[model samples]
Target chain A: MAGRKFFGHAEPREIVAFLTGGIFGSGLLVSGMIDTKKVQGWLDFFGAWDPTLAFVLGGAVLPMLFVWRIAEKRKVSVLGTPIPPRPAPKMDPALIAGSLMFGAGWGLAGLCPGPALASFAIGGWGGALFFLSMVSGMIVAPTVAGWLSSRTTS
Target chain B: MIPQDWIWGALGGLMIGGAAAIYLLVNGRIMGASGILGGLVDGTGRDSMVERLAFLFGTLAVPPLLVPLYHSVDTHITTNPGIIIAAGLLVGVGTRLANGCTSGHGVCGISRLAPRGLGSTALYLLGGAVTVFVFRHVLGVI
Candidate 1:
């Protein structure tokens, strides 16, 4: 309230967010990022690697770069919401370790969170299992961190 | 004729970026899927429940709708329950620990030229590439 401005009711903003998410989901579906074979293939650089994932990354990044540039000049969003804070640039252990673990998991399964969710429509029970397990992991992470910190302190 | 997958992949990427841009411009939020989900589950995002849920609802609902229109939403996920569970848990814990994932660090973070995003992206890619090499070439499990 003090630092940021809340425009109108959150309903409109929620609707907009939903619409944006729909587009994002559709894009992931269409781009083949949601497909495990394609994702695996892209990661298979030494084997029969497919370069499509790189293209998807490039394609997605190009436009957002412009948006970020515009964001730099503005204080509030187009809807008058306060601009979110930029994450600090520090490369702490958590960043590196978490990313490494995520990458290994991604390579092992050929599915990240986005594609994992998208796969729900088609991946059947396997998808459900992955989603459930991933959620469990997320729920447990903080506790794990706390435990680790306690162990280190003791 | 253009390769259908390439064309569609690029088109989809543009749409994803556009969606991210819209979320940023209109809602004043970063469209990181893991962050959104992680926060909601972890209780850190209580203040913005409506916003997060709305965005998630869109993401979850739209894909199923498109399944009828396009038969290309198929996924070739591994059938091994062990691998699937392991991967899921890793993604869950790893993303929360790292604070981002492909969408947050790979796409949105890189676009903003943030160091953490760049570093996370590079490390994950490296990690993925290495894992692939070991699994496919050495162990031949996948």
Candidate 2:
């Protein structure tokens, strides 16, 4: 049953996934994060700085703070799946370096993972190009990460 | 009146987190967008490919449908293929190496106040600010 496809299930696993995805989808659309210029404006602290993203971050975090508490106390989810409590997150070189790398990319184009996907609805060459390139980049990431890990360890 | 951008953004933010909460409570999975895509594409989550693909499909499908409501989903990304490719590659590589992104680390991790999540989020925020200063302010090239 756990191995069942999303739609294939009689249970609500896939339906929940779809509904959440819709929330995330419309959230981006509503928030105007799909607007690359606005995203850039949020990053443009030195220029005409737009503080909308700060609010977005703050608003997004508020609910999740409560969600984490509820999640932490739960043994199983409402859908009857195991809810694993997260441990103390470890600080490592990869975390430092990778975060910086991702930030640079995000600032460069003002497109993060969620916005990029949401923007796919626009049906533009720019969106298609970026999405494909990002996917291709993800495909090779493990190899790059593996090499980085080996190099750092050695 | 409060700026529409902030109002809409906050409302959307609440929705985003609300959706994530649903995913957490109902699906028992962290609602990190990059991790979902990265896991599936990278084959690390091949076993859950069904679920991941379904999530991807839903998110991707729902946005276009909202066009009737929101009118347009303009992303305003740069047309320069060079910039697009470079940015895409960097995002992919960086997120995978660090193991999270804005949704994962920024929203999910920071909300929980986890060390790695907090640390990564700080570093990326700094990285983004510095990059914007150098590229947008200094070079004037996006």
Q: Pick the candidate with the highest lDDT.
A: 1
Task: Point to the candidate with the largest TM-score.
Answer: 2
**Which candidate number has the best DockQ?**
2
Count of clashes, each model: 0, 0
- Model 1 chain A poorest ten-residue lDDT run: A1-10
Per-residue lDDT over A40-83 for candidate 2, one digit per residue giving the tens place of the 0 to 100 score: 89988899999998888888999999988988888689988887
* iRMSD of all candidate structures: 2.3, 1.5
Off by over 4 Å in 2: A1-11
Q: lDDT by residue for model 2 over B1-46, one digit each (tens)? A: 8899999999989988898889888898888889999998888987
* lDDT score for residue A66 of model 2: 93
> Lowest-lDDT window of 10 residues in candidate 1 chain B?
B68-77
TM-score of 2: 0.95
